[model samples]
Target: MQTVVTAERLWDGTSLHQHPLILIEDGKIDSIATHDSAPIPARAQVHDFPGATLGPAFFDVHIHGAAGHDFMEATPQALDTIGTFLASHGTSAYLATTVTASLDATLRALDGLANEMAKLPQPGRARPLGIHLEGPFLSHEKRGVQPAEHLLAPSIATFDRLLEAAHGHVRLMTLAPELPGAVELAAHATSRGVRVSVGHSNATAAETRAAIAAGAVSATHTFNAMRPLDHREPGILGTVLTTDTLFSELICDGIHTEPEIVRLWWRAKGSERAILVTDAMAAAGMPDGEYQLGGFPVQVKDGRATARGVLAGSVLTLDRALANFVRFTGATIDQGLRLLSTNPAAMTGLAHRAGTLAPGKSANLVAIDAAGNLVGSIVGGIQAS
Candidate 1:
């Protein structure tokens, strides 16, 4: 079946390319046409958004939980609940990120997620791109919400086991490059098609560069946890800025990184390289109070969440992150849209089908009102929850 969706404007993420209608066929873009030039064909449905702009469905590289559901729980039903909630907000896909916890709990969660990923059907709300392992190997001093006791150096055997158990569903791993065997572990993970991101570390500039040279392509939540950028010897941040290919993640929730710094990173890295991620937790779509991240107790207050008084995760939604980027950076909607959508997909190697609205690309798109509210979301040519 063919469908035509028309909007007041269109943003492919890379740029704002407004046309009268977008033609979707067989769950992929068939053509982008001007409504005035082409007559609507029979047997085709037309969806019109008179005053809204159509944009690529957002792709969140990092997110833990939302809407009274969390990924760390690792239940199929729980993930589906989260997926339904995310789709309503224009998220088409995301990595179910895990925080540091007991080895047993981590393993159980990983094992469960591996199974759930395999059982999921094709049609749904936002889908899981893969599992993102954010802990078990980190710097205790900067563990954030990760349990200190669970923080340890990488063990190839254990890491390999977990990855194998996931059966290639684990897409990214976060680690501190200064730890023993960290560089080697990152290299191996990258070799297996999983990206390595530097984070939760106090690694020096040299150490960070070494990790990047070893295939670490990103910094987890740039300007947080990891060493701050210094003038003489820029630390992890310096390494991110210096390496042209280095893509860094950002939490645009105003609290995590100030709007000014967010704008700076956007300017430096360009929208294509700075991926907007919701370092979100269970409290994201819930009210302020106690929640859980990877089985650890978390408390949210004043829109921020913490574990044991340390900044734990976040209570932010991806749509809100996009608004923050616009409000803080004063960037046009086009740039912010790319940072939250196409760019993140590119980093994860899923841009081929999921990112922009182009001929032959999967029809993952969202409609936004002038006020930045999410009006509607679509995934694979279907209306998402």
Candidate 2:
């Protein structure tokens, strides 16, 4: 059976073209055709979405947890709660990120997710791409809300143990390049199909470059706890901007980084080079108050959550981040894909499996109005409507 989905406008997200009719079969897109640009073949099931827009489903590679579920508490029920929360906001796939904790606690969470991953054939809740391990290898100077007592050196031996325990379900790992054995650990993790990101650091430019050279493909929460920009030394920001190979993630909550700085970053890196991530926590979509990230107590004041007054995480959603991007940057719809869909997917190596509404891509997508409101959503061809 085949399905031809027609929309008033379809931003392919992969390219600069906005097509009309998108043909899909099974779970993958078969082809995309312009509204008045192609002849409709017979027997093609037509689904019309008039006065709507279509783009690739949003991907959150830097999310910690949501809906009262933290990834460090990777239980089946918790993941399901988080997944359902994400789907309502137009994210089809995500990396369930864990926080820094005790070795026993971290391994226990990983072990829990491993069992759940094996049982997620139907995934009736939300979709999980892979696990994002945020710490266990981080810098104490810029640990933010991560449990510093649990932080450790990035050792290949310990990494292998964790990876095996994870059952190869780990997809993303964040490490401070300045940490001992960090470069070696990045290379090892990359070789095992884990996307490496440099974050929670105080690394210099040279150190950041070394990490990238060793296979850190992305930077987590750029311009956060890491090194600041220096005219003489240029620090991590200089290295990240200069290195075309490294993709970066931004928190975009109006608190993590200033809106003016957001615009500056957009101009410096461009949408295709920088990605927007929520960096959200359990308090997201919930009331502003005390919450937790990696077992550390966080207080949410004025929509910004912090641990001991240090910025812990955010209560921002992907939709809110998108809205913030436009409010801050004045970016047009053409520049939307890279931040919302394309860049994150490409950086995580999930581009082929998700992101973009092109032939053979998953049917995951969202339709937002001029107000940036997600009015319609589709996950694996199933409409959430």
Model 2 lDDT per residue over 1-385, tens place: 6767776677777554454877767756778888778766688767676766778878899888888778888888888788778877888888878898888888898888888777743322457778889988999998887877788988999888788878889989999999889999999999989989998998889898899998899889998988888899987778887777788899888899999889878877886788989889998888877877878788887898888778888998887788788778888654664586888888888877667776766777777655555676667666654
Give the per-residue Cα lDDT of candidate 2 at 125: 41
List runs of model 2 lying over 4 Å from the truth: 1-5, 16-19, 23-31, 37-52, 120-125
How displaced is residue 5 in candidate 1, in Å? 1.3
lDDT of 2 at 66: 84
Clashes of each: 0, 0
lDDT of 1 by residue, 143-202 (tens): 776778888788777788778767778888998988999998988888889888999988
TM values, all candidates: 0.94, 0.91
Our tally of clashes for model 1 stands at 0
Worst lDDT run of 10 residues, candidate 2, spans: 119-128
The prediction achieving the highest lDDT against the true structure is 1
Candidate 2: pairs in clash:
none
Model 1: residues >4 Å from true position, as ranges?
A: 13-15, 42-45, 120-124
